[model samples]
Target: DSNFLFLFCYSTYSNKVFSVTFLSLAVAVIIPLFGAIILLKCPIDPQPISFKEPPVLTGPLEPNFKLRQAERLFENQLVGPESIANIGDVLFTGTADGKILKIENGEIHTLARLGHGPCTGREDEPTCGRPLGIRVGPKNTLFVADAYYGIFEINPVSGEVIPLVSSKTPIEGKNLSFINDLTLTRDGRKIYFTDSSSKWHRKDYSLLIMEASDDGRLFEYDRVTKEVKVLMGGLRFANGVQLSPSEDFVLVAETTMARIRRYYVSGLMKGGEDMFVENMPGFPDNIRLSSSGGYWVAMSAIRANPGFSMMDFLSEKPWIKRIIFKLLSQETVIKFVPKYSLLVELSDTGSYRRSFHDPNGMVASYISEAHEHNGHLYLGSFRSPFICRLNLKDV
Candidate 1:
C-alpha cells in the first residue's frame, strides 16, 4: 500500500509540473504570435525613407553647453511659445492654448484667442487651436499661424482679430492640414508660409516624422488679392519659412530631411529650387533671419549618435515604425526621444557659422525658433512652459 501511494504522489507532481510548463510555453508563443499579427496588420502605411548620412558634429557644428547660460522668462506661466516676433520692444508669441500673447515689460497679456472657450487640457488642442508661428506685419499687426486654424491677422493695440486664411480653403483640391510658419515681405504685401502635411495634424507631428511623407508645401498669399499660390510642393515636413535678406529667395526648413531649401522668388533664378543646406546634425524647425546677414535655425532635437540615432534607425525600416506605432501612442513615442537643444546660425549662402547647444536640455529643450532682436536671442519652444532669453554678448 505504501509503495503504491508513493508512485501515485510522484505521478501527480509530475503531471502538475508538466501542465504548468505547457501553459507557460503556450502563453509565450501565443503572445508573440498575436503581436506579430498585429504588427503585420498595422494601419499606418509608413513609407521607407532614404536619409542622407547626417553630418558629424565638428568645427562650428560641435556640441557645447553654451545654451545652458540662457535665462527662462515667465517660467511655468506660459506654455509652448512656439514662435517669437517682436514689435519694437514688445514681444509677441503664440501659445498651445490657442492664444496670441503680447509680452511687455515682464507682463503677459492675451492679445487674441484663436479658438472658442473651454480649453481644459492638451487633448483639446485640435478644438482649442494651437498657434505656432507669429510674425509682425505692417502697421504692427500680428500675423499668426494656428496649426488647427489658418492664418490670422491681429491688431495688437485694438485686440481685433481678422481671419486671413481658412484651413478649409482648398489648394489644388487638397486642404491645408498643418499651417506652420510665416514670414512677411518687406512691404507686408505677400505672406509666405508652409503647410507641414496634408495627412497629419499638428498633434500627430511625431507620426508625420516617422512616416516621412513628402506632402508638405510652401505657399505665397497675396494680402491684397486674397489669392494663394503654391510656390513649392513635395516637401518633407516643412516647418519654417523666411525670406532672404534681399528678398530674392525664400528659405524653407525641411524638418524631416534636416535641411533648408531655397526657392527663388524675384531674381534671375525665379521659380528655381535648390538646396540651401543639407545633412544637418539635427532636425531644423522655425528659421528666422539673423540680425546679421545670416539665419538662426532652432533645432528641435539632435542626433546624439551620428548614424545610429532612433530617427536614423527608423529611416530605412518602415516595418519597424509600423510596429512601434502599433504598440505605442504618439505621445509616448515622442517622450521616448532623447532630449537636446540646439540653435545654429547659417550664413546667407547656407554655410554653417556657429551653433549653440544645451547638450542635456538642462535649461531649454525642443527649441522651435530663435529670434534675434535687440542684442538678445529670444528662444521659443513647443514643449516648454516658458521662453528662454540669451544675451548675444554672453555667447
Candidate 2:
C-alpha cells in the first residue's frame, strides 16, 4: 500500500525468537519490542475526509477575516514531519519513520536513514528511533530531536551520526524520557528541547491525558558552557519552543492547555510567564518565530474529543478515564473533521491578524512547523513527504 505509514513492526523487523513463536497470531497487535501482544478488540475504520481551500487574500491580511489552506504540499501521507529549515539551497526533512531526506527545488532525495536508506525498505522495529524536529546549524550540521534516543546531530556532508543527549544513567541517577521537539538560541550556543512525558508513549495519547500532571518540561543544553539546566517544568506537554526574532523571549506551547506562554530572557518580565495565545482551536505542537516578527504556531491538529481540552481535570480521576479509554480504545480507524483555520498570531499581544485552513481533512497529526524563509511562505506537513512554496500574499 502506498499509504503504509503505520506498518506492523513484527511483520518485518521481529527478532529470531519472536518470528518463531508469534508468527501465527496476526489477530493480535504485536508490539515488536514488547513482544507479548496485549489482547485487545479490533478497531473501527474511519472514512477519509475531503477539505475545501480558503479564499485568496490580496490585501494586507486581515486579522478579523476567515482563512483556509492556500496550497497543498506533498500529497498522500508521510508520518510526523517536524521542524523545517534550509541548509544553503538544499531542504531537509526529519520524519517519524527514522529517516532524514533532502530536497532540492521540487525534487526528493534520500539524504540518509536511521537504520537504512530510504530505499532499503527495512522492516520497522524501532531502528532510527523516530526522528522528530530537525534544524540546520550554522556549520551545516543537522540537529534532530529523536524520540527514544534524545537529541542528535548528523553531519550533512559526512553523514556521520553523533549523540548529543540520551537518558542513559548519568553519574547520578535520573531518566530523560521522550525528548520530543527542539530549538536553538540566537547565537546557537544552547539547545532547548521538550520532554513530553516521563511515563507515557507517544502512541498512547489517551494514557498521557489520563495521567497528565504537568509532567512535560523544557531543558536547555549549553554548548559553550557545557551545562544543562532544567529551565521550566510542570508543563502540560511543553512543545514548540521558539526564540523570539530579537532573541528577547522564548515562547512555548502547552498543548493540553491550548496556549503559548512566553518566558522573557532579556526584558522587564524576565523570569516571569506571560500569556502568548490562549483558547486555540487545536493542540499546538511546534512553533517558530518569523524573521519579520510574530510566530508560526503549528496547531498540530485541533481538539476533537472533548477530553482533549480538559486533560488536567481528567487526569485526576483514574476510574473515569479508564472507563473512557476502555470504551474508545477498540477502534482501528479514528476519524475527525480537521479544524478549518490557522492563525498567524501577533508577537506583541498574541492576537490573530491572519489565518489559514480548509473544510476537508487535508492535514493531520504534527502537520508541520511553518517557516518564513527569505520572502516566501513554505508549508511543510508532518504527514506529507514534500515541501511546498505557497503563493500566499501578505495579510
Candidate 3:
C-alpha cells in the first residue's frame, strides 16, 4: 500500500511539471508574436487588381539593351536625383541630400540646400534634406517639392530659397505629408502636386508600398489666393504629376497601381479623374512632356517573374501580409528596388509609343523621371547616385 501511494504521488507531480512547462513555452512564443503584430500596425485595405489586361510587352523596335549604353552624367556626385528642370543650357535637379543642384557648362554646382545638416544617409533625411520634385517656372523660379520640407520656390541664379508652402498645410481638415512631385500650370498661377502617402514619411516609403494603402492625395496650391485645395484623394501611392501640353488635363502616376490617372483640369470633364493607362509593364513613377510631342514616363523597376504575381497574391491575404511585414526586411519585401530601368513613351492620348529597357541596369536603374531636352534624355533616379544622359537621336 505504501509503495502504491508513493508511485501515485510521483506520477501526479510529473504530470503537473510537464503541463506547466508546456504552458510556459507556449506563452513565451505567443507573447512575442502578438507584440510584433501590434508593433507593425499594418493597416492594409487592399484594392482589387483586375488582371483582365496586361501592359504590352517590348516590341521589335523597342530599345532594350540600347539604354544600357547611356552615359552616366554627373557620375556619383548626386543622390536620388528625382526630377529635372531644364532652362537653356542648364539642367536643375533635386537630390536625395536635399540640395538643388544645377549642371551648367558641363559643371555641377550647388544651387541651394534645403536643410542645414550633412546628408549622410536616409536616416538623416530630416536633418540632411531630401528634395523629390523640381519644376522651373516663369521668372526663373524653381519650384521644389521637398519630401520633408513642403514646397519652396528657389532662385537658381541667386541660391535664394523661399518657403512657399508647408507640407503640413491642411486640406479638408487633414494635414498633408510626403509632398512629392509638383507641376506648374501653363499660366503659372497654380501648382499641382502629389502627397505620396499621408500615413508614411519619405523614409518609410517601402512600408507604404508594401502595405498598398490608399493614403495618397493630390492637391493644387493657388499662387494668388494662397490656398491649398485637395484635388483628389484615395490615390494608391501617387508619385508624380504633370500637366498636359495643352493644360486641359493632368496625369498623375499611381505607383502602386502601376498606371496613370488623368484629372481633367479644363473642359466638360473638369474635376473628374479617369484611368489614363492601366496594367503598365512596370511601376510608373513620373510623367513629363517631351519636345518630340509625346510624354516620357519613367518606370522605377520592371515587375518580373514572381514579383508580378506575389503582390497580387499577398494583397488578398492581409493576415499573411502582416506576417510578411513582421518577418521581411524592407529591402527584401519591396521588389521595386533598383533592379531594372524602363522608360516608356506615350502619346498625348495615353497610347503607348515605345519602351526603352535596360535589363541589366548597367547605366541607370530605378528611374523616377526622364526629361527630354535638346535632343537628349536626362534621366533621374530615386536610387542611383548619378544622373543619366541618353542621346535620343542616336537611338
The prediction achieving the highest TM-score against the true structure is: 1
The residue ranges of model 2 lying beyond 4 angstroms of the native Cα positions read 1-69, 76-78, 115-126, 169-174, 266-270, 303-320, 330-343, 363-366, 384-388
How does candidate 2 fare on TM-score? 0.71
TM-score of each: 0.92, 0.71, 0.85
Alpha-carbon local distance difference test for all models: 0.89, 0.59, 0.81
**Residue-level lDDT tens digits of model 3 in 316-393:** 566776666676766677653447788888887788887778975877877889988888899999878898889987
lDDT of 3: 0.81
Indicate which candidate wins on lDDT.
1
Residue 166 in candidate 1 has what lDDT? 92
Greater-TM-score candidate between 1 and 3:
1
Ranking by lDDT: 1, 3, 2
Worst 10 residues of 2 by lDDT: 44-53
Off by over 4 Å in 3: 1-53, 56-63, 305-309, 334-338
- Candidate 1, position 33, lDDT: 85
